[model samples]
Target: MTDRTATAPDIVTGAGTDDACCLFQRALGERFKDLPRSVRDLHTVKGESGWQGRARVTRGKSRIGALICRLVGFPEEAEDIPVSVTIERRGDMELWRRDFGGKMFASVLCLRNGEERGHITERFGAMAFDIDLQLADDRLQFPVARGRILGVSLPRALLPVSEAGEFEMDGRFHFDVQVSLPGIGMLVRYQGHLNPVRSDD
Candidate 1:
């Protein structure tokens, strides 16, 4: 599927020309403008062939953190794995659907930014958490922010950090993501290249 039309201007901007929400939203888009335009579009992009790639996930060194990864349903292995990712823009939020080694995972990301607030839903609201972002020069960092389990906030001290960097290499779009904790070392890191495949969705 292709969303050829542009999404409407953000409603939050109607409050005022210099409202905090409007400022942050514009800043967020400007920071990552080097990426695919669809990344900033609040509309779905899909294809029958989709995007194909490879990923490697390295578990954290801390034993407790590794255990927590298992408990939280993270794959514990550190090896090269084939994967596919499908991203769709739904309203103001984006849905990233990934299939790795036959196990599917999905996350919902809300792009509105204003002082880092609220629990963004994921997996169709089976999970939700607030996220803190550090966006700069085509790179985005998800510094550990407060999270919620069943709407109960988790301690800030226990959250982990994750960051992503995107660029073009060998004429293909490339991205790298790393997850780490203060005392737990690195949780997982994945890097891959993707090229668009044209097809009717």
Candidate 2:
């Protein structure tokens, strides 16, 4: 699906800019171009950006899973859930703050260091996850390569399973993310569409 032209000068459309490519572009390398413009436009932004959307959220039923979800600020089950996101550049990292029906949660994203170079690291409090990305057809996937808490690595069996990605449909940006744990059946799964909300909005 083709993306609408951005009237704002700060909006990023594609490559060949005097400034370096954004985080996703740098990590995906040559495969970045394969993504649909709907996905590319959101990831290519260089500065602070805002997005507004709606989602369907499903929270885990397990007692322990519910507790964990609450602790992590995961939103309650709902359809057509109001969603808003803000992405801001902080040094070499990008801070993503999301509000799902006013249940706010945020994380820090940055390229991993050392042997895990090229991969992305998403940190939530003291827990950090190393994500290995894959591109399939017109979709971008994120799989946990490694997970650590308080600087200690977690066993693979203990790590949460994630089925997450961003895709394009009918010229709009869409996303699906389902996270589950070893004992917990499901933590929270949310799928939705996002459209850029310019500063003037």
Candidate 3:
């Protein structure tokens, strides 16, 4: 219900010069211009911005899946839940905070260097996933190609899997993100639409 992004005036600094501030554009290069207006705008993090929307938060029914979701502060199963997202830039890292109803979780995103070149790395708690941003049919897809726990790279077959993407429909930015473990099935799936919060709202 609260728009923390609008109030975080100190989140952006003029000196912060990280491509992650505008992650998609950096990765897609000139092709970024071909994306839908909504998708492009939502991924462009300038300072701290807020987006509001609705989502269906579904936790996997599996025992381990539910436990993992709960441990990561995921929202309980719900439909038409209010969603709020805030993206803040701190140096080369982008802190993305999402609120599903009253429950909130955050992740840090940046461009990968080390071993995985030209990939976007997202860190949620102790798990870090390297995602390759690929555009297909006006959608930006996030494919988790590699994963690490506590900075230690995991084996190839043991890496967690993710099916995520962003697009636009009916003039609103929509996203579907689902992550799953090797044998644990789905971890969580949240699909919804978001619009930039305007001053009038």
Ranking by lDDT: 2, 3, 1
- Please give the CA lDDT of all the candidate structures: 0.51, 0.79, 0.78
- Stretches off by above 4 angstroms in model 2 are 1-19, 114-118
* Root mean square deviation (Cα) for candidate 3: 4.4
Task: Compute the lDDT for candidate 1.
Answer: 0.51
Instruction: Give the range where candidate 1 is weakest over 10 consecutive residues by summed lDDT.
Output: 1-10
Q: TM-score each candidate.
A: 0.64, 0.87, 0.86
Model 2 gets an lDDT of 0.79
Q: What lDDT tens digits, residue by residue, belong to model 1 across residues 53-147? A: 77776666778777766544555464777777776544344556666656565565564343233223232233355555564664444554556
Candidate 3 Cα errors over 4 Å, as ranges:
1-21, 114-118
Per residue, candidate 3 scores C-alpha lDDT tens digits across 1-201 of 123322334234336465453766666778788899999898787677899999998888899888878777777888879999988766555788899998888777777762333478887766788888888988888888888888899997787788888999988899998878888888888999998987678
In model 2, which range of ten residues has the least summed lDDT? 1-10
Worst 10 residues of 3 by lDDT: 1-10
